[model samples]
Target chain A: MRKIIFLISLAVVSICSVTTLSAQGIQEKSLTLHHGSIKEIHSTLPTCITVANDGSDAIEIVFPANVEPYLEIEIDKRDDILSFDVIDESITHRELNAVLQKNPIRVRMSTAVLSDILNTSDMSITFEDGSVGEWFQVINTGTLFVNGEVLAAKKKIEYYNTGTFTSKIHSYNTTILCLTNTGFLYTNGYTTAKYVEQSSTGIENTDLKVACEKLSISTTGSGVIKYEGTVDDVEIVSTGRAKILTSKLN
Target chain B: MKRLLIFAVSLIVAIAECSAQQSIDELLNREIDSGTTVFKMAVKRDPETGEIIKRVKEFTTTGNKQLAKEFVEAFESERDNVDGWEENRNGGVVQITAVWVNPKRIYTITVAGSALSVFTQTIYREEDKKSK
Candidate 1:
């Protein structure tokens, strides 16, 4: 009797989910990119995530909002190729794959679920490519602190996105001869950008600047910051070679 | 002239040092210019010697089924010495290991929806041991 009751309940749940998915017309999508080369990653899923060449070998990707649980994620590898599939049997594979390749993976889940996915899911690696063969190492060069929260890279391009994002330089004796308008830097999220030196050695001669509303910096190394654009408020903590150009901070 | 010469030498040294420190397999994987980060590859390094033992690359498709299928086709084209492959339906993942005995190299590829990780390692061959 108990077994029969359990089976009936399972059937009812399955039927309800199928009916709900049909009503919403959720689709299945798969995305594939060569493992070695990834350049720019931008999404229009209302949740904007931008990433660049910061060396990270493994990163979790985000799908649209609350659809995390209902969705089935599959990673298929054969030969040397890898395929990422977001399965929603209700939708056609052809249509879903096309959309994912072109834009962000969006699902028509409830807004509440969207909030949960954004807040809980630690999906990362928005962009990747071979511009820097080992961007994972480059990105790990330092720990960026934005308003006391740690920040990870969102998008990496050969050129800086000058007007949109602010990039923090944590490299040793790195020189940006000049900053062009190719691509700028942005925080992991919209927050005050800062740097926390994680290396035992000090960082030196890092020429960096940004155009943002509020900027906070804290570093325990020998590094110099040059602001190339306007800013509203700035706070800095320095230890060894840490200095911000007072003349340019205004 | 002296300063220019010093700068040139320094640049060459720096480039050489960077190349020497990185594994050739990692360099090869890093050279590809595909625009997605879902796929990942790694190498197994010996603990005491710090030498690379093998290389493995793994990737997944999340919204482009055709591209994923095509990529698999392309990858299989270069299967020089695949020892074995297994497909699991539980999560629809695949694990393939290719071994080249002469070169003493091993490649293991694994793909799961949440993770796609591959690794490669070069092993000491029995032939080398027998010759010694």
Candidate 2:
């Protein structure tokens, strides 16, 4: 029988190469929600969770690109509002401990060991709403944005010194906005810059017009970012509110 | 060779008598302000008041009429602990401000065209405010 069709075609090519390597692996999903029970987990890559709560309460874990009907989670009992949807293999763990022996809340979902945004260089963005821009222009180097989104240029810097300027400095505790070398404004705490031509040989003019909500310019040189709201060219900028337009608002 | 030129003039008088008592918190040498242009200076201390709060100096001089006559001879050699002094001239630019009191100090000098710059700031006059 032609060797039984070559052993059933090598067992159907070994079960189609183990179902195509488990559908291109990297899918973790874990769950552990007690205290009223509302658990669910699902992943296809892009996870980083650690919700360890039991004592010393203080637990707030909401992830899924942070809500937007994208797996909505807003549970703060006793004000009476319960909305739920996380059914993926329908509740287990003894039916989530019989619904956490009548709602107590102890969630423990897994699958979030992520850390490979090209091995991270450092990124910190926080804009529950928006605001960042009084004056902005940071030519290049390990991006930094405050008052919410306006940064994304992970790596690709070149300017071996036509006059030095290197980047990889990120330290923000917050005091409003202030990022200079020639751009980024808004500061209502303590701002001081007195570099009257600090040893110039040329090209160090730091042009400024000022007014911002959340600005960060310099896509590549002669930066003159004027904004009223929205003008995509790159580097995170969205959800308006940026002043500083004495002129250039046509 | 005249005893090697008197042993190289006694090794330049023993390195100018070991730098004639250096210290202005040291570091200021191009043979001690020759043509000047020294930058990057420090001497800050105050890890919870260990004193010597500051002394951040920066220098630059391109002759500027000999560093404005050596900064008016370093503000007239700290004229009796200079309690206050100021000089400002427009047009060819020249600025000098001084304030010193024993260990506390602040001296600034600026001159244009041919450039000349200097700043020395240090404060922390304690020791029971020196009997005052």
Candidate 3:
């Protein structure tokens, strides 16, 4: 009975996690990018636990940087898989072939179970194609940040709603970068126009300005924010000074 | 001329160092502009190593069926609310917004030279209701 109940919960969680994988009408159960990569990982993994999805290798569970990762199913089992390692190198998508060869594991897409993936890993790499390849990672909304300023008392922040529904602002000024239905961030200037409320503007997103400093930006509502481009280093420097450059990415 | 050359080299090194100091947002914006649907992005600061790590994942969509509505009058239509809220389809170019859906967390997204960077700040109340 315990095993049966666990299976039922896993099914629900898997349902929420799945989306369309291709245009050929093929439905994949659980997928790890490296488990399917054509380039071989060269067997760098210390140990690989293999589980098959249908007939093909569905998932490759390995830690490229060698770190301890814990998977706790929030809904069903408290712990089903657990391993800890000391990380040394960084994990990148290009190394998928090397890692998967040693850790050819699979994701069990059966039922709904609450699981939060926690890792003590150190590094990740962004590919030239703009895609970030992460190891021992699962995606979910977590926290907010502040840049372009020291992130002190009363920093300016603006929200631009590009999406339709007005973003649901739980509250404002009270949080680090004031989160809503769309995006997250932080600030260090003072401005009253910084409205983080549950309601939203009309179909079009409005540009918000707090401190002439352009402390923060948002898309939780329906608009876009235009500001000078500054890396984190520059953002942490003196405020009020704006930058000018015709910035474009290829 | 000698002094000018030395000053210019120092300035170049400083700028190069700053650019290499890419944050979680810069790396992410780079991926999103290339047509990746960034679902969730997180940052962690290690007290031991003092290294901050940013992690993100992208997924293809099947177009969820959000609660749709109808407008009785043409001008008073709330229909566009659902059609083009998160993504815009202009003939061919599909421009998608990178968003943070977590409550109390504010995310600022910016784009520069083919790269997009997002910084997040969490909102909390002094009285402390929840999500603090």
Candidate 4:
């Protein structure tokens, strides 16, 4: 009877240890949306996220097996809108792929993630709505399309469009570094500073309607910039018949 | 009796200071209505000092121009006590920047063209002065 009691205690200890080890390994979470639209998907740190339209009714996220252990996903529904927040707890960088339906879902991320993914391989994302946050630093070597707001508050958000880049940007206090090779950018927002550097044989057209405190524009080659807003300060350096058009904001 | 009088005065002064200094969250919640949709609110801190350097808040009113107008007016009322205040209006867009000295912070408010969205940011004066 004594030997049997010792054996039973050892078995209980072994089972508890295994259960604790399993809990510390991989953490997976899921939520199925029955109603409401997805308002935003926000990530705490810079993460490599691939969003693709699968034409499904429900939003589904599939994490790669290798990096699944380091991600924490949370969904909050308030006032008939779903807000998805992702926190990346990994010290090392890893790729995350998410497939969802195209309509009524907005994905927000730092432009650094897009730059990282584009550097590794070619990626194209087509969705209904998307937004780029404040800390954006991207050098695009491929086609890029953004049909949403590019917001910056404290630091200057920089983007080097060196490929076929097209965007309808509502910017705030951001400096778009350069636009080269088939770049078409339409901007309308509040800007403290704006720098436009256009070059190459490809025509770069920038239409800006902004309430700007200052604007410093430098254009070369077949580049044209149109401006219409209340600007406190303006500096323009143009070569090769580059046009800068300004009209009063009505 | 003199010591008791001094202690009472000290307690009153401390309470007044505490009531005057309101945090960013408290200030916003008190000024703005709860029905407004809060899009995002984020803060950045100094890594070394663990001091909050910046606070940003974005919200949409869903085409409620009256609410947006009221918010701008509420900030404008405090212009007399601020260190610096400036208001700019270009067509339907309005931008306001105010610098406060007590907490040493700067506030920037922007109301979009349709008055459907508002973005506000508060930055520490020390950080702003350092960048300048």
Candidate 5:
């Protein structure tokens, strides 16, 4: 599993460069979804789906103080995703084929200590600005304009590094490993993260998935998101590195 | 000697961990330019000729269909729109003065000599449309 993930991560690192594209001259198509999150098969539907946190830089969801946020079950269809950077800006979104995008989501996990991140325990989210946080999964990657510079963070990043650079990082409170790519793998009272390969080929794949989950951020004070980047097929979360796999959801 | 070996190994792991960090630029990594919507115009077939024009003449329609209807007016309006509107925005309603069907392409398009093309996409409402 680890081997597969490493290869994928290496590949993702390369593709990450040209991820942003323009939505030029596209005929404006307005969509309306009844719910919050929408999930579908990509082959059947290739509709564009954007997200909005209403009008806030972050979407606020106050779950039970200790309750973790899971995959937003229902896929939402809306004419526009609310742009938070602006007071009242709207974004055009489309319905993504689940197969193409895989299942990217935003989950709320508990927070760990700085020691955990420094220790490289489980997953780690190291930001270019040196701000670190943790999560279980990323929903989408969005542009982060810090101090006036725009950066790209891939969406649905399960595991990755601070991208050859960083000053800030985010780590989660969970032990990091939940379900392995092959079967159920757990991290019991240890900082070390291991992979359980369902098949020999999945060694890297399993490890990468585990790391992604480890590095994922829990949008607690701020909502967690796995954003679709300017380019299709890639999602960004908080302007960070994201390594994804094509395995079916368990 | 053993402690020194452990320290060296630990240093390598730390260096490897640090190497993973990239100068991933998030700021200025925007999706669109100025969040501005762009508009373009083109000419279709000369209605009198009733002959189809080449693909380069106008923008292609997005959906799948074949043998669409031919028209002339769709072009004129778009030309005017391009000359007039300083800016176009998403969700903003712009008229497609000249819209002709590309029978061969099986789609609708903003003909040349027309204004900005306005797509007639549906909006999803929670309640029934009849109620609204």
Candidate 6:
């Protein structure tokens, strides 16, 4: 009887260990936000977030399962629109991966998360008042308007400009490219307008006022680019009636 | 006597140009020995005109703050020899861009933060084109 009991105990221990190991592995969880709902995300720790739009009426957020224990989800109905406040309560340093889809949302991240990377497409994100980061990349077709002070080290913005893109980016290196159709881009700070390549039928009107160390502008469309800044070295290439005006060269 | 005076003036100009070029070469040698070349580009020219347009080369010293400071000081020491010099500071970052122009070419040096960039632009002379 004692020998049989020992074998059963060993089997139970092995099963428990396997279950704990599986739970510690990577897993995912998905949550849905109703259409036109306002979702505000706040993280206590540094987090990397990627946001995109799929034209769905509801907003979907898929996050790593490990972060679920640290998350606090609250929803309230105000003026017929649901508002969600998702707060991260982790105190230790861990990378929280949150991928959001569809609908517009507001995010407020602290300076500890400044080194985090933000990737966005086909959606609108408004940086609250004063937000800083190391890298922010915008690609594909959509509108991105940042009405705040964003101090970053590098930014690469590719705007199809189905809508307007206006931001104040203070970065050491910045590259802006406007492609297809017509749109407006306005920016101010220390800018090195690396290359602005436009198609034949594309019209992108850009106005930039910056203190530039090196300015390189190239355009091949009917776009008008007006620049005002203190420039050290400049190389301008324009064709097809693209108007380029600079305070120093104009 | 007029010919002799002109020859003396030309000799002085040649000596000055040689010394300036030698200093630049020495700085480049030191950079090669101590720093790492992060980026480099050869001189580019217009296809039809064959006129040299631009060349860019950049070097970094990893995270050695002392070596970076030494490079910045060495570049600043050449400010008096260049035609134009401008320095802009934002927070902890410093940017220095200088232009040196001669009868045959234009050179620009830009130092942003710890990286040093050098650009060269060749001036197209009428006599040289005719000879070609």
True contacts kept of each: 0.00, 0.00, 0.00, 0.00, 0.00, 0.00
lDDT of 3 by residue, A84-195 (tens): 2312345543354344344322232211111222221211111111111121112212221112211112332233222222222222231223323333222123323322
lDDT of 1 by residue, A75-105 (tens): 2222221123334566554455344343334
Per-residue alpha-carbon lDDT of candidate 4 for residues A1-250, written as tens digits (9 for 90 to 100): 5432111121222222221112325332322223223333333222233333233334433322333344444433342222222335343323333321111112332222121113211223332323333344444554455443444423445555555555555654455534444343433343445543333344556676664445555454455566666444444444434455543321
Per-residue lDDT for A1-250 in model 2, tens only? 4432111121222222211111224222222222332122222212222322223222233222211112223332322122223323454334433332332222232211111111011112232221112222222222222232221122211111132232222222222233333322222211122111111222222232222222332222222223322111112211112221212211
Best by lDDT: 4
Q: Give per-residue CA lDDT, model 2, range B12-126, as digits (tens).
A: 8666534332332233333122212334344444445444455455555464586466565656565544668788889988787776554567767787866767677665544
Candidate 5 regions off by >4 Å?
A1-22, A34-176, A182-250, B1-132
Candidate achieving higher TM-score, 5 or 6: 6
Docking class of 5: incorrect
Model 6's alpha-carbon lDDT is 0.43
DockQ score, prediction 1: 0.01
Docking class of 6: incorrect
TM-score of chain A of each: 0.27, 0.20, 0.20, 0.45, 0.21, 0.43
DockQ winner between candidates 5 and 6:
6
In CAPRI terms, model 2 is classed as incorrect
lDDT per residue for candidate 6 within B8-111, as digits (tens), equals: 99998777655543454466445433213332223344546545444434433344556556656765777677667777777756666656565344444444
C-alpha lDDT score of every prediction, in listed order: 0.33, 0.33, 0.27, 0.44, 0.22, 0.43
**Docking quality (DockQ) of candidate 3:** 0.02
Docking class for model 3 is incorrect
Candidate 4 reaches a DockQ of: 0.01
Report clash pairs, candidate 6.
Answer: none
What is the i-RMS of every prediction?
19.3, 21.7, 11.3, 19.1, 13.3, 17.0
Q: Candidate 5: what lDDT?
A: 0.22
Q: Assess each model's interface with DockQ, reporting 2 decimals per model.
A: 0.01, 0.02, 0.02, 0.01, 0.01, 0.02
TM-score of each: 0.25, 0.25, 0.18, 0.33, 0.17, 0.33
User: Model 1 misses residue A46 by how many Å?
Assistant: 33
Question: Candidate 1 DockQ category?
Answer: incorrect
